[model samples]
Target: MTAAATAATVAPVRSSAGGNAASLPAMRVAGLEFRNPVVLASGTAGFGMELEDVVDLDAVGGICTKAVSIAPRTGNPALRVSEFAGGMINAIGLANPGLEAVKRDYLPWLPAHHPGTRVFVNVVGNSVDDFATVVEAIDGMPGIDGFELNVSCPNVKAGGLEFGADLQALAALVSAARTRTTRPVFVKLSPTLGTGVTDAARVAVDAGATGLTLVNTMPGLVIDTQARRPKISFGSGGISGPAVLPIGLLATWRVSRALPGVPLIGLGGVSTGDDAIQYLMAGASLVGVGTAALRDPRAPERIARQMRRWAEREGVNDLTTLIGTLQWPS
Candidate 1:
């Protein structure tokens, strides 16, 4: 959709100087309501506890854990990530404490979390059953508010788009895990697959996804032009940074239009309040910051501040009213 259409669909922001974003009406995703619309991206925020002091944890929308596997993973070799033109490439290979350890270590620490803060655990699996196991295991864990299925990782052997490669596979993964718990499921998608996001998003919902997070990092690679070798040890990695903001906006807008009732969480290269506003205007009900948060854990608050200023400038009243307002220019 054109930017002009996006503008037309959203309600103009009605300004109130010195407004407190926290005082705005709450936003909900899959039955989980947040004080605001900011979420700490999965990988960038770790298990959601590391930045408690820097951020008023209880005030933010939610937190998602770094991607976790069914079993412990050592991750990629050293030099697994490298900076590029407008983003960074990473092949971290979903490094995490795995399910068992998460239950033993991460779970215990979660209950002590501030009650107002919502936590979502991200689960990844190589096969249908693997995902079910992880989801079932994490269900009802002391403090987890929801589960986000990570479908953007690469499959070592499949010459496909990983969990997102095929709709049948994605549906199966969702179907298997949906039966295991009552916690809401948010399917994390990828931008690499391009327009396929629409189909994948719908399929996930039909299979039982309560919400959608668009997107996972776009796959990328950095080469040492002088040395004639790849910059990352894993060769190719996921790309994320400001460069992805536009694409992320488009993806979020499209999905929101296609699935008007399901909640959509936007992520990709968001570094400023304007970026968050752009996502809002494009139809994202909630926005997640990854790379920027990695650089500065307090970035979410900074973005929230920026959002208040921008909303006032734009004449927008309730930000949630801006969702799916995007349209094609006449």
Candidate 2:
């Protein structure tokens, strides 16, 4: 379908901002309601607990906890992160305490401390079954409103990137995950997929994915000229921050245009409200703040406030009207 047609047909379902107020920038996706469009992207904010002291976790719409696997992961070697001219790169390798620990320690904290903020567990795996395994285990877990499948992590040696590129594997993976949870399942896609991303989005949605997160950081390598070696310990890492903003926006536009009915959590290099607004105009139901939040823990709330201010100034009472309103040249 044409972008214009899709935009008209897909009407965003508005919901209350958790009864906080009628004017709050609230939105609902796949039955999960967000108080606003801004969300703390995974990996940057840890599990929302890490930022408790510095940030008001409930200020933003929601938080996507770091990738959780079936087993614990120490992650990549030393130089896991490095800075560059455009943005930052990191090879965190989905390092986390794993599923059981998440169940025992991580999930419980959100409800008690940040009751207003929504939570989506980012699930990773070394294989097809592993994805479902973790999701199934946490399906009934309280405080988790949904799941984001990390099938596009470039830093991993095994199943991460491989599952994203192969349509059959991607289909099977999403299908398996779909059966394990009744909550929303968002497939995080890779920006490096180029023109094929739309096809992948179709496959995922057909396999019963609830939505798509566009996208994960692109694979990159930063060289240390003085040291005559790669700066990142993993040699190559996933590049994030401002450098990936356009890449992610383009992916969101393509997928949103093609699958207008599918909900999208637009993430990449967002630091300010204008950046978040661009994602909304490009058709994202939600905007994720990662590198910016890492740089400043207060960024998520600030961005959300900025969005509200911008909306009020522009007289856009319902932020949902701004979604998928992108216009292409005739």
Candidate 3:
């Protein structure tokens, strides 16, 4: 299918509540309406159903499942996650049950249980065709609200940051994936792109991305002095937590400024309602909670509750007004 044709067919599925209200914290992004602005970042939430016993799934704005590839992956070796002073590093290697298993096991269960919660699948692959294949597999699957493309994943074919670092490659990947599904496509970017984040945002949007997810985990390493070895199984892993809050904020600000009116989902180091507000002010329509959930499975719901309290306390009737309201020193 052509990009234009796919775009034309894709429409935002309205919430049961319908349009946003001034007194509510609801938001609409790229046709998907969220009850709140706090989303569970992919990889941390484990396909959106794993936390049912501990978390109130319907409480958060949405849930992004871990990266789903065309084939099942075992991920990295042991010690997939390790903590630092301010944050944590992980090299889970996108371990997932593959698309077929997801469709059979998870999709049906979601709608029957958490009907109100929005579910976005995080799609990852080693090549542009790989991404397209995965998206095609889940195109019309029930209970899936949208997709967050993990373009920040290293492209084995092109090498060197793969699809994310190269504008042409990123556009091609997005365009290919766009043809596969009419669902909203959110491109998850890398902070390592620096000023390139703006360029990437433009390319992704122009290539048919419905929205952008600013600032995936930055790469980092933890060392063990006594063992003279890296802490995690992988020599280097993505860093996430409080340490990346400023990085995520700056990326959101830059991308929002560069691409006005485009929906953005900001993540990295968002553990509190205040942190979420910072992201909103910086230009993120929605904020994602990841590492904090690792520490406490109920963190996303807690953060959302706190955000609501904060909004009420400040007398901000509408949370949407907070977007891009940052005041800078002239």
Clashes of each: 9, 0, 1
lDDT of 3 at 320: 79
- Which 10-residue window in model 3 sums to the lowest lDDT? 3-12
**Candidate 2 residues 1-330, lDDT tens each?**
221222223234554445432225567766766777778888887888888898877678888999999889999989899989989989988899989998999888987887768999999987788899999999998878999998873324453457889888888888999889878888999987898999998888888888889999998999999999999888998999999999999999999998877789999989888999999889898899999987887787788788878888999888889888889789
Model 3 Cα shift for residue 55 (angstroms): 1.1
lDDT agreement with native, every candidate: 0.78, 0.84, 0.84
Model 2 Cα shift for residue 152 (angstroms): 1.6
lDDT per residue as tens, model 3, 1-330: 433233322122333543432113567766767878888999999976788898777778788898899899999999888999989999999999888998899766777788777888899998999999988888788878889999877788775566888898999999999889888888999999899889888888889998889889999999988999999988899999999999999999999898767788999999998999999899888899999999998788778778877888999877878889999879
TM-scores for every candidate against the unseen true structure: 0.89, 0.92, 0.92
Candidates in descending lDDT order: 3, 2, 1
Clashing pairs in 1: 5-327, 9-325, 12-315, 12-316, 13-315, 13-316, 14-315, 14-316, 241-269
Angstrom error at residue 202, model 3: 0.7
Off by over 4 Å in 1: 1-24, 53-56, 154-161
